[model samples]
Target: MERKALFFLDECRTVISTSIKKVLAKVGSKPVMRVNIGFSSIYVILAINAWTGEVVVSLAKRPNSESVKYFLRYFKRRVGSGRVYMVMDNYSPHKTKGTLEVCRRKGIHPVFTPPYSPELNMAEAVFKSLKNYMSNKIFYTIEDVKNCIKQFFKENKYRFNLNAITYLGLDKIEV
Candidate 1:
């Protein structure tokens, strides 16, 4: 049998600035946090290897079909030639004809999670970890957020155990 590469795919939007409603501080001293009222944000499209925990990330201005296609191309290039099975959510852009076409051209098979079942996608855990890593931190600009994301992944490339998190028993399957 031909080798198959399995990946969990997802996208998330990171805002440039976030406001924290609560914080731990000394008594009688109010904690001040810089918050950007502007809605400037960037979308991150990410894919993680189900067996190896390898990751591919892309920053996009918008979370649309075009961005999905672009990420698919980028993923293909990074992963090289292989039979890829990408498990993703049922986002509208993920099901668009253009995105499907790109997946077909790149030899990527999309396996979507059941409707409204984001928990089934292991990528959600990665995103949650990323959010926690960035929590209580201030980002001055979209670039700052982008740089932070890159640094986070770079410093913690093996932070996640895909086999354990996904409960997919990836290690038991022959690649």
Candidate 2:
């Protein structure tokens, strides 16, 4: 498979929060409704391959060093022995020496998005789309929300077009 480095980023704030605070606000008297276990405050990351516009969702938690390692390992297994390049924001975990060393050992090259440009990270757009799909829908348990997420990936992963991803600055990525 052809490999290309692409911008990456994480978004933790759920769309539900925006709707509750901005769009449809609760009226007076009744208890203010909060998004239940339906949505997580956890960070979700995507490692997008620019060449094919194929996105691999990583750990759905904080952007910590351990989480980055887990993602790298997952990526390594997915693309065994194929040298690959990845682009990501300069988040603290990404910059940590341990994280860099792990990537180096795994033959994964990391590129960074330009400073202060969120629009350039196509992975962020992926999460936004996921959030848009999840907004306001209540799930009795976290597993229910997870099933929805899994379904989304299964159904739409191949449908993502390179043209739209390029618009999100994915084509700008380089080795």
Candidate 3:
């Protein structure tokens, strides 16, 4: 599973957007660039099923223990009928009492990646795509970001290429 954070702005503002080519102007003419001032950051948690590459996402106002717990409940429901060997990063919220309790009840045994090793959590790759997709893009409101994200998740449903997860191998994840 992977988790990421995104900020959204209510107003659109960009003095100079992304440009593919350099301005061929006098040396004294420097271009000024600007982007909309972001207002709130939405904490998003993403979980992917390795076998099917199915992803589920949850958004919250804060990235705290309560939110993690909420996401865990969502994950448990998504996981359906079995125990899960959920690989995760060592985020503090992952170790919260509420989250642990949910895991215990839901039969989700979270295996933490070794400290300082963010790469071990495969969700980073998915989020990287999300970032690139949103980079330099303008959104008029938070709903715009939400709608875009919804579309992204929909189009990419079960679409993650999991060749990097060779150790476990494909079709070996579901229990």
Q: Give the TM-scores of the predictions, in the order they appear.
A: 0.85, 0.73, 0.73
> Which regions in candidate 3 have their CA more than 4 angstroms from the true location?
1-34, 167-175
Q: Is candidate 1 or candidate 2 better by lDDT?
A: 1
User: What does the lDDT come to for candidate 3?
Assistant: 0.62
Which pairs clash in model 3? none
TM-score of 2: 0.73
Which structure is stronger by TM-score: 1 or 2? 1
lDDT of each: 0.83, 0.65, 0.62
Q: How do all the candidates rank in terms of lDDT, highest first? A: 1, 2, 3
lDDT of 3 by residue, 84-105 (tens): 7777777788888887888899
lDDT (0-100) at residue 77 of candidate 2? 82
Best first by TM-score, ranked: 1, 2, 3
lDDT per residue for candidate 1 within 26-142, as digits (tens), equals 999978877776588888799988767778989999999999999999999999997799998889999999999999989999998889987677778788888877777888788
Best by lDDT: 1
lDDT of 2 by residue, 76-164 (tens): 88767756767777778888999899889988888887788777666766676777777656666555666667777778953356534
TM-score result, candidate 3: 0.73
Query: Model 2: which residue pairs collide?
Result: none
Single out the weakest 10-residue window by summed lDDT for candidate 2: 13-22
Residue runs of model 1 more than 4 Å from their true location after superposition? 1-3, 19-30, 164-175
